[model samples]
Target: MSRPHVATIKEMAKFHTDSRYLEHLHKISQDGDNDDPQSGDFGLGYDCPVVEGIYDYATAVGGATLTAPQCLLDKRGEVAIDWSGGWHHPYHPVVGTGDLCGTGLGKGTSLWMTQGWVKVNLWMTQGWLGVDPMAGDPMCSFNMTPVRRAQCLQHALCHVLSCCVSVLSFHPVSLCWSY
Candidate 1:
């Protein structure tokens, strides 16, 4: 059987109206607040840890001794944990509108960065690298303005280059692709 394209609002509206769709909507709504670190993002949050755990478990079942924390790096760049789950809200020892900066990474101070806020952080963290998204840096991805998105994407792409410097020798004719 052929699989259908990804679902979208327009496509769903064209389908036969039925309670089945309504049921799915209801399921999503009920599970929406699951960003609660306590609840584990309605179970999707287990993806990282479970993948790591299984990979090692297969080799040993009980023979693998690696702890889940030591084995996996979640979006936060650390061991997967309930608290580290990106909530996109809640100020972590800092002031901001939401949690997890513009990059969607958790650590590095979680919070939503307004446009004006972005400008500020850029100014402050100019000398320092990796300022918190809440720092109001224009270069920081946390800033939600369209202009900042470009700037943030630029900075992120540049960082990507630096990160791959070691591997650059492997692929002499590298090509960059973006969406």
Candidate 2:
């Protein structure tokens, strides 16, 4: 809605998706040939056809998925929503499923958490333990590290964004807030 923030090629590459695959998709979308028998390629024929804006379409969809979380992280909104997201499938990473970069979300969140961005309620903190009481919870019992908890939260947030209207409040480090 806000002029549509789009993720650049480099940003998407952080997910470790094969860059060549992305490039090929772009090429096929343009005047380049997708079904080149000379190279023994059969990727873009049916099911995944080589349309006019294939590359832009993929990046736009992927962009929506990435941007919503960013809005929350930037403190721009308590909850960010991307209706187009929830289920992402990029064939370059894997066949059919396209979720090899699934680890990308966790990796990104963990990085932010280390920088004191994401909230770590399940982790064993020096002071406030947040919602999860240190009574008999598995997160505290195992003494999970902040990074691990951040990674777990990262995965959970992915589902949360996709799920219909779930309210979760994550606080930045030092600046605490209600959940």
Highest-TM-score candidate: 2
Residue-wise C-alpha lDDT for candidate 1, range 75-152, written one tens digit per residue: 222222211112222223333323334433343443333443454333111111122342244335453433443355
lDDT of 1: 0.29
Stretches off by above 4 angstroms in model 1 are 1-45, 51-111, 116-152, 155-179
Q: Each candidate: what lDDT? A: 0.29, 0.46
Cα distance off (Å), candidate 2, residue 142: 36
Record all residue pairs in model 2 with backbone atoms less than 3 Å apart, i.e. clashing. Answer: none
Q: Best candidate per lDDT, number?
A: 2
Residue 13 lDDT in candidate 1: 39
Runs of candidate 2 with Cα error greater than 4 angstroms are 32-47, 90-179
* Model 2 deviation from the true structure expressed as Cα RMSD, one decimal place: 13.5
User: Model 1, poorest ten-residue lDDT window?
Assistant: 164-173
